[model samples]
Target: MDINQTTESYLLNAIQNKRLSHTYMFEGDTLETLRRYGMFFALNIFGDTPRNQSLLVEGNHPDFYYLHTDENSIKKEAVGELMHVMNNKPTESEYKVYIIEAFDKLTPQAENSLLKFLEEPPEKTIAILLTIDKSNILPTIHSRAQHVHIKGQSSDRLKELEYLSEADLQTLDVLSLNAQHIKDTGENFTKLRSAAAEFSSKWINGHSLVLLDIKPMLDLCAERRDYSLLLQLIDGYVRQALHSKLKLDIFEPFKEGVKVDNIIGVNHLTNMLDEIEQANKMIQFNVHPMLAFEGMVIISKG
Candidate 1:
């Protein structure tokens, strides 16, 4: 079966077999993509009838609750409101479904507020929490929900990524398959990725002062969020290098230059990826962007 058909079959079988979980964490590509799957699964669970479909499409479905926020972080108040609404019984259907998009964006208070509800949701109430990255999700929440990894775009979908070279596409495919995110980031995506690739290349080649050498690239970032993206891109390159070194099912070798497998040990690359994740978290927690970058480099070097 094709990608669409494959996903449809999975959902249909889940519904037919009456195997739906009380809580699900749909992890993958982008919020938009996961939302589509979440809504599809919700509709299927609700019988896919015309009236139910219209109600859901128009956001008037009494049995379905949708929660999303325009800001980066979702507050406890918002989640509490959802909990309050979900506490009631479904009016129209045997099951009530609630979908929370960008679940990774929930603040610590919000996640903590949700723990009890998720752990003991009202009977016949199904919760679908969607996230682009599951790493940011709290361990408590992660443990409570059944995780579903939505597969990324297929090869045919590569047609939409015409802006990136074949090698670039291969590199990014392992990192993220969200074409919209690349389009949203626009030129900065390409530049930051290039900067990251260059930085990784130098580090693997034993270049001293690799961190200082990338200062010009750092200066080009006009926004603090850029640091997060830059760190993510660096992590991606490091991962790609690790794959190359391990002789895994990599599409291409590290795009920058020499292979790092011989130069850097697998454990070191793994540790570097961990440090990069820490740097990204530092950036998320309002650390000075440059300091986070420098700290990652200094700590990795040590």
Candidate 2:
């Protein structure tokens, strides 16, 4: 039940005034947080009590439908199945509620199918689409839904970062970094993150000559064909460096080992992030992984 009070109040007011929209887009810093809010909102709509709240929380409610992908992405068939269920009358509550997690991961076909459903949602039914990256959602679908932003209080950032080590914060998928992910992935992720931090530190410090030292790591990325993860790691490092220069009290180990202020200005860091993004796009267009990485590193030198 713990969520952004402002968001909760706004939704409550909408419900009280009978102004709740048929389709809602819930955006937050992380998927888990948005999922919690989605569940809270659904329970309220169903007039759920403490005794029955467990059913909804556990996703066992007849009227409540939860959609997510266990595979790489949500396909068209999944959307069709969901539509079939949604077309049916609510079994218990007055409203049938569907919460779709990772909404941005839906394939193009699935997205088109979902758009049709959103355009003409079933009566007495609500659809909640959750995502960390709003930009990934199609503009056509975005235009049709009410947007809700769930934000934690500003003072909570330090507390949230407290549980994370510098490496965890640096290497984390910035969009999905949370305590649970850290706990579940554990030390292996941290080690990979540390490797990224080391790579970034050496590159930023004019130690491009040390490429030979990290060639094994680069080879590993090329062999695994996960250039995206490497790019994200480097992006995280740059973000941490920017935050450090801004005097934010976030955990950034590079602040201690390297004089970030001396090596790169905020402008340069910003451009480095842009370069990394372009390199990621290149990989998507079939550029060789090592070539993309080298190109990005060279661009960062500017």
Candidate 3:
């Protein structure tokens, strides 16, 4: 499904059946998407009105908690705040939801503080860690909570155009097969951080080359939100994937260090490819397309 369709349908399903998970990791590459889902969950699940939604913006959600990580790392006090919030009972709703946006940025000390809470979470508290990457999360926290791997919305029109550029008449395809991989590696922004360090010289040397073709993907990378710095790297990598996997002739320095796995089926790849375009459009309207495309590229690399 496309980005608009996916969110619409998912929210519909959630509202229709109330199959809301207590803790969700709305893992995507865009900060906007992160906050968008945060709002969606708050408004729908807690029945907050437009006025209350404004309060959520001001970090005043009565039943909600926002967690942030500074450039240095997530502060130890953040965990303390969380513990305080969880210790108390729900104020307005059955679930006192916590939206831990960017929890993966937590410092080691910050992460450690929450081990006890994750193990035995408050009976009525639902903690959703909105993250681009969960690599930093402790195994203890990961194991205790139910893992909801919110994959990227399916590929959009840009992806469809990507596939159409190939010379061969349907000789091979990248979409439809990597659905699960897309979910697992949704918006592999974490990879870009390491890649930059690992390939700085190459990236710098190819700076001119990268700049020439980085604009389109960069445009789709969304605004310079919290995850802005890494968006360009991500955009470039997807360009590499589109050219490499789908056989498009995009010229850029290919990134290394990842073990490419090309075993996904056609169905998953097409769906993801289609969603990529929808996500791009959404990004044009201020939606975050980073993670959605990131997921597709990760899956395609496989």
Per lDDT, the best of the predicted structures is: 1
Q: Model 1 over residues 1-302: C-alpha lDDT tens digits?
A: 23367777877897899888888998876555677788888988998899998999999999889999889789999999999999999999989999999898899899988988988889999999998767668888888788888865545335566787766676566666465456556656667677778887777556787878568778757666667767767777777777778777453423553446365788888888888999889988998877887788888877
All models, RMSD in angstroms: 5.7, 5.5, 14.0
The local lDDT score (0 to 100) that residue 232 gets in candidate 2 is: 70
Worst 10 residues of 1 by lDDT: 249-258
Tens-place lDDT per residue, model 3, 64-134, is 77776546467888789878977888787667778776777787887788776766777777777776666
lDDT (C-alpha, whole model) for all candidates: 0.78, 0.72, 0.52
What TM-score does prediction 3 earn? 0.50
TM-score of each: 0.65, 0.65, 0.50
User: CA lDDT of 188 in candidate 3?
Assistant: 45
Rank by lDDT, highest first: 1, 2, 3
The model with the greater lDDT, 2 or 3, is 2
* Candidates 1 and 3, the one with greater TM-score: 1
User: Across residues 19-67, which tens digit of lDDT does each residue of candidate 2 receive?
Assistant: 8899999976566678788888988888858744988867688888899
Q: Mark the regions of model 2 whose C-alpha exceeds 4 Å error after superposition.
A: 27-30, 48-62, 68-81, 90-94, 102-115, 131-191, 210-218, 222-228, 239-248, 251-292
